[model samples]
Target: MSAALQIGLVLFPKVTQLDFTGPLQVFSSVPGAKVHLIWKRIEPVASDSVLTLTPTTTFADCPQLDVICVPGGFGTDDMVNDAEMLDFLRQQAKAAKYVTSVCTGSLVLGAAGLLKGYRATTHWSAMDMLAPYGATPAKTRVCVDRNRITGGGVTAGIDFALTLVSILVDRPTAEMIQLRLEYNPVPPFNSGSPDTAPPEILALMQERIAPARQRRSEANGRAAARLGGDVAAG
Candidate 1:
């Protein structure tokens, strides 16, 4: 029999719950899949939203996984240079078959030195930050560059995970999962993307996101500096 697919998602403080949870629902439903919510400790971790998620495994105890996923949120800024967290990611990514992230989580992977020379994407507000990591940032909802797949903003995780489902299993499996979730999206508003939103609304949104974007840009610069060599070169 084939071995069960071992998948792990990093659970950190201030994470956007849906970034990983949306994907969690899809991944956990996979047959013979072992999904773990990993953190430094098995504790209740707070998120940007109201929910607090509990971690299933501590970093020290997490088994080598086939996939390592990270989700992004306002909390990601602090984790950019978090030595312990970045070290854990670097270690897991070395042995994992796939290394992935959602939203600003790509910034985390870049911080871990995993996205060097890869094409990736992040939340629209933080997309440019990928450049310093020696990554080619794409302006899309989901980007799959080699084995390093990345999703855009918070809601993009489900789409990214579904894409991953197709890669890990097959199209049939992903289609079935999508059907089960009734995942057909019909967003009530066409303002999801900056290109589609009214100019005034887009400007206001950019204004609100500016501070975070600035912080992220600064953090990405530091991270790329730390990574040096290739990241700087790229």
Candidate 2:
């Protein structure tokens, strides 16, 4: 490889590790690629589960990235109003070749003012939140409107990463990487999406997530106000 492609994945408490790890594996597998786990400080960050990961770079020393990926989970509700974190994302996205997110990470991107006027997707539950950021919400597995690429839900990270690999390199390279990862999908249950899931299950999930959704709404309202967007719709 003639030149290295620098990739950064933002790390925070309660983030879904798979969202970052899935893409990290794909990018790191590419020759001449430098993948970074980034945070305010270089320390071990715990995920939503017991899984933990250490940041490879701090905000101060991190170099310009070719790709910036923001993953989401329970922490995102807190992060949307975190000034320092949002500023970090805004600054990095300004210089990155591609600004990306997986799941509810799009909300973080929105809070940073990066998703303004971009068509982006997020978890199905929070897809409508994009409106407050002046963004058009796209409800898809993976949505790529210009350089602002976003993925829907948690497991969609792998699919989004593979799609991104094709953009970063070529279709054949992405294909090879997928094959190496043995990325064939054969889910035992066909109820991954809200449309496919049984009504009872969907209702249960919504009930469980309602509190977090309320938190997210409040955070987005603040973020919208900060970014000079219409708070009413947020």
Candidate 3:
């Protein structure tokens, strides 16, 4: 029998619930897939929403995984310069078959020095922040550059997971999972992307998120500087 596919998702405080759960739902459908919610400690971690997730394994206890994924939210601000978290990701990426992230989770990967020279994507508001980490940012729902795969935003996690499923298993298997989940999305409005949203609405959103974006940008700058310093020190 083939070995079970081990997959781990890093769970951190204030993570966007959908960014983790959307991919979780899709990955759980794969036969013989062992999915783990991983954190520094095996405790309850709160999401940006009301949802609270419990880690199945602590970083110290988790087995080497075939896939390692990070899900993002405002919590990424805390992680971008976190030495322990970045070290853990660096350790895992050494042997993991794929290193992936959803939303601002790419920022965490970038902070870990993993996204250097790779093309990646993140939530639209944070797209410009990728370059400081030596990453080429793509404004797409899902992006794959070599072994790094990234999702654009919270809802994009489903698309990202399904895409990864196709690569890990097969297109037919991913299709079957999509069918079972009734994954067809037909929103009541065509305002999902900045390009599709009405100009005024887009402007309003940009204004509303400006403060958070600025804060994250500052964090990214510090993280990138730290990574550069580490490289120089080595």
Q: Given candidate 2, what's the lDDT at residue 10?
A: 94
Q: What tens-digit string does per-residue lDDT give for candidate 2 at 36-115?
A: 88998988898999998899999888899989999999899889888888888878888899999999999999988898
Model 1 C-alpha lDDT per residue in residues 1-234, reported as the tens digit of each score: 199999999988999999999999999878899999999998899999889999999999999999999999988988888988999999998889999999999999998888888999998888778887878999989999989999999999999999999999999999999999999999999999988999999999989878877887787787778888544477
Top-lDDT candidate index: 3
RMSD, one per candidate, in order: 2.0, 2.5, 0.8
Cα lDDT computed for each candidate against the true fold: 0.91, 0.90, 0.94
lDDT of 1: 0.91
**TM-scores, each model vs. reference:** 0.95, 0.95, 0.98
Candidate 2 clashes between residue pairs 3 or more apart in a chain or in different chains: none
Candidate 1 vs candidate 2: which has greater lDDT? 1
Model 1 root mean square deviation, Cα atoms: 2.0
Query: Per-residue CA lDDT of candidate 3, range 200-226, in tens?
Result: 999999999989988999999999999
Off by over 4 Å in 2: 229-234
